[model samples]
Target: MKQLKILVIDDEKLIRWSLEKHLSAKGYQAIGAESGEEGIKIFEQNHPEIVLVDNKLPGIQGLEVIKKIKSLDEEAVIVFMTAYGSIETAVEAMKSGATEYINKPFAFEEVEVILDNIKNKLKIIKEIQVLKRQQKDIVTFDHIIGESVQFKQIVHLARKIARTKTTTILLLGESGTGKDMFAHAIHNDSTRHDKPFITINCSSLPETLLESELFGHEKGAFTDAKQMKKGLFELAEGGTVFLDEIGEINAATQIKLLGVLENRVVRRIGGTQSIPVDIRIIAATNRDLKRAIDDKSFREDLYYRLKVFQIILPPLRERRDDIPLIANHFITHYNSQFQKNVSHLNEGVRAMFLEYNWPGNIRELRNVIERAVILETMTSLQPDNLPNEMIGKIEQADNSSKENYTQGNIGTSGSIVEFNIPNEGFSLYEIEKQLIIHALKKSDNNQTRTSKMLGISRDTLRYKMKKYKL
Candidate 1:
């Protein structure tokens, strides 16, 4: 470590000499100056790490010298020394940027301790600055990769609304369309960035547990109620709470949630008093909430309240232009995460990715890339790296009009094979089995190509293969 240099400026010759001697004995490079002007000159020449100036000086006052030194180097540590009955001046010095103030006739031990404390504080401040710089430099937008106009517009809207204090946000989109990713991004960019972001899938939890999970429960609230526990709302205090699969919440839970939204308060189960809470809410659902209200499954007032800032994410097929960006993002992401050097996707792979209707949206794309990265041996991901469903859709152009196959088939898989005219109709399972075999043949038994040609998940295709004893 570099030796600390301390400059002492005082009109008293004895005081300056004594302080200089004491500091030097303690392993500090101490310099003494008779006047504030001389101190500044020495300070400019030596650029001392710390400055100690007396309140009374010949020309410039102690506080003025401190200001000039600070103007030159704001990080330079400074301490003001004052005689008795002039503590008011010392306080004014502190407000003027003095790191510390010391009274006259200061004890050598006290001075040493104060200097040590200043050094430690400066070290901590430096460390905090470095950490903040690193955090600021890191890229947080790695997950939501897209360049299409529709995708760009959605991202832009999310950013704008994130700055607002809107308590409720409704994210409407089909399953796997990256609604959760956008919700997280909004929370990260909002004022609650430093606070907790609690996410709960309404459909994943049972009704009884869902109520307790969202709004806490007092002791003895239910048969198995062991102790009091905070719920999602209280846990996410001063932050945001994300409700995924909002449509799946039943009417009872809906009523309770509505109370929280309207009153900004929640009562624990079996508790009489309601406690105020501060929480922003973001709700996501694939179902049409308005229609659900009409059906009496959801409350109309809650629906309108949650729609304060609405964001409707388009499906992957609707934003076809973003395929390459999304694919390349996945390639880069999985490469680092999986420790694979997989570089790019081949032309055939890219075509299949764009042509296939991603019913699962971005979620399906991520899974595809993850699988490809794990199974791929070559530097580039070829068409075979994808699932059978994706490949099947790419090659099913001629047979597109079949009722069994829609533009975006959820899990349907089929193929063309001339079969003998049968007297009885074939079972759904039989027809499905025939389609898989024909797709496999058309792709020359290449599972990747066959899976793409079949428009089914590779796992599904494999399961069917074993089922048919192929």
Candidate 2:
């Protein structure tokens, strides 16, 4: 665990000594300063987590010190220590971003209680920050639902590359194939997981503003630039910077980005000094960069720079075998989110899901499941609960299949099969058993291929085969 560092700033020698003694006994590294100026200098040198400022100081009042410390680090937690009859001053300190106030002439026990309270607050704050980072990073691929060979291979490659420190990664896929999720997973799995993971979409901003946003600017760099500001690259030092839609960046910005990749340094928009940065860049794009290079829309050198390690995420249509698993994952997720008890997708809905091409990929499927979960009252998601577009596509495919079967075209192309149920009502278990046997025979008893043909997992097929005494 990291030790807590505290800075106690007071004009009174006894108060400073008492705080230093008590804080040190409590296992904190406490430093004492006799005035506000001296305190600011110490804070700059030490960068302590907590600062205790005396409300009345010899020079440069405590409120000014609080303001200065906050200006240096906005998240700096400061507490104002005030004498008796200075409640108004303490309130003013609170308004100036002081976290809490400690009244003077207070007992040592009260000081101990206040220090413990602050320590607890700081701990909770640090935990929350870590939680937020994990939520953003781990949730992406931690519970990724897939068992298809192609999907598994992609995940394996991603995991293999995530252990490296400096390899630039490029995710190539369609818009909704979860490139951002892969980026987050790679960052979270890397050595810089504790550091920041910053994301910026290239196409979301205009060219000039986008440049400034990435490289930052010095004071008076632009009409709106009033003070020096750190850019995303500077802020994400020792971590990952995920640039989504990297192909959309303009030519000039592309040149600058290429420089950053080659030199590992960034220059502010109007500043001359080149600040070195240590960051892992992970870029994603749906556009064809090779074609963009041909058309002179993207830089070829930069494209090669970004593709040092590339992962192409397969579209959902190609991984239909994983739909059921992914859908069930969403059902479980939305059950807690929307407070619904939807346990599964009905048979008809499941069939429709397998038939649909899923042109928008996983994102569209997640949205569909979320909608169904929100509006569904039954225990299972039904076909009618699906979107109109999906239902129409499924119905159209069903009609086409029926027409083909009527024309005796079933199995002619070896792509379509027709099964008929008698009016007396056949057993679903019997039908499923026969289908499984047929699939097994078609695959030459290859369970993996059979599972793919049935759009189920190999484990599920194995369990069913055992249950059916096959």
Candidate 3:
């Protein structure tokens, strides 16, 4: 940080010089004035961050000087100087905008202590301003790069619901499907964009700690709770609270969260008062919460409440046409990040990305591009720049499709459909089960590859597999 200017104003020449000299030696750029009028002129010209003024002055009183300076800049940190006899006047000076008052005979050490405290506060304020700017500029609808119809529709729908006063938004998607991005974009696009957008992953903490974090505990509420604390919901008032991995919360926490959703109020663990909170709740998870509800792990009522504005982000493989476009976007991003001149993916690299099923979705693609950008010596991304496992997976898929096609299996795309119907009519369940088994066998029992062969999510395949007792 640059040197902070401190203005010292006193009627006595010695007091002004002594304070300025002491503060100047301490690294501040301290200046002085003989009278309140001179101090006002210097203050308006230089805009010093801190001001020290005396109670009795030649033309104007110190309290009057404080008011005038405050009129010019309300954020000015002013400390009043007075004698033992003028303590009453010091109190009056405080009422008129003085930050603190010290006796005239006070030690220079006292002044240094006050200045150190003010400096700490100024540093904190500056850091907060920087963080706010970064948050405001980082995530938005415009930054979401997708040209596919499904992706565009999801974005448009999210934008529409963001403008509303919807209390709860449930983002359903697989891991790495950009649920976190959607949560941030939705909050940044909402009416409370300027407020804090606090987020937490419920699964990251133990059940007890997660409960305490959500509904803050009072002092002495628990052994380690030394003081009263405000929870994220209270801190995020007038904005949004993103609860990632919401399905991971336990039954007790689920009941409490349901209360908050119903009443828009939260009570600390050991407190009696219900603090009202004005915020939207954005819950996201990669789990099949509907299945969890059936298994009694998730509360049905809470699911319905959170699903008021549900948005399911499709997997990356479902939007194959956007792979090249998304890859180019990541290539440009990593190019700027790593200071590289990587232009675009070569045709081989492009086909490898399209041929492979991105089980990790956009996040996986981003990592692939970032690695390629960092390692590639040529201008354009090449096949060797890709991960070896990706190429291996593609080779395996090609061989499996060919083998299944040669076996006269209709599961492979563009293959002829030739299945004999039982004379007594076939059972659809048996046919569907056999097809999944055949696909799994050809794909070497890999869930990701098997899901791609069946044109479904890995989670869906697991559910069907469980249903068919396979």
Which pairs of residues collide in candidate 2? none
Query: Which portions of model 3 show Cα errors greater than 4 Å?
Result: 1-137, 410-470
| Pairwise lDDT winner, candidates 1 and 2 | 2
Candidate models: Cα lDDT each: 0.84, 0.88, 0.88
TM-score of each: 0.57, 0.65, 0.65
Worst 10 residues of 2 by lDDT: 407-416
Compared with the true structure, what per-residue lDDT tens digits does model 2 show for residues 172-287?
99978989889988988899888989999999999999999999999999999999999999999999999999999999999999999999999999999999999999999999
Per-residue lDDT of model 1, residues 385-443, tens digit only: 78887777766852553444332242433324444435664555666677788778888
For residue 22, give model 3's deviation from the true position in Å: 6.1
Clashes of each: 11, 0, 0
Cα lDDT tens digits, model 3, 1-470, are 89999999998988888888899899999999989999999999999999999888999988899999999998899999989777678789889898888887888999998889889988998999999999677799998878877889999999999998646999999999999999999998999899889999999999999988888989999899899988888988898999999999999999999999999999998899999999999999999999999999999999999999999999999887688889999999899989998989886677677678999999999999999999988889989888999888999987786565445575535552467655676555676688889888988999889887877655557667877899
Candidate 3 accuracy as lDDT? 0.88
Query: Candidate 3 clashing pairs?
Result: none
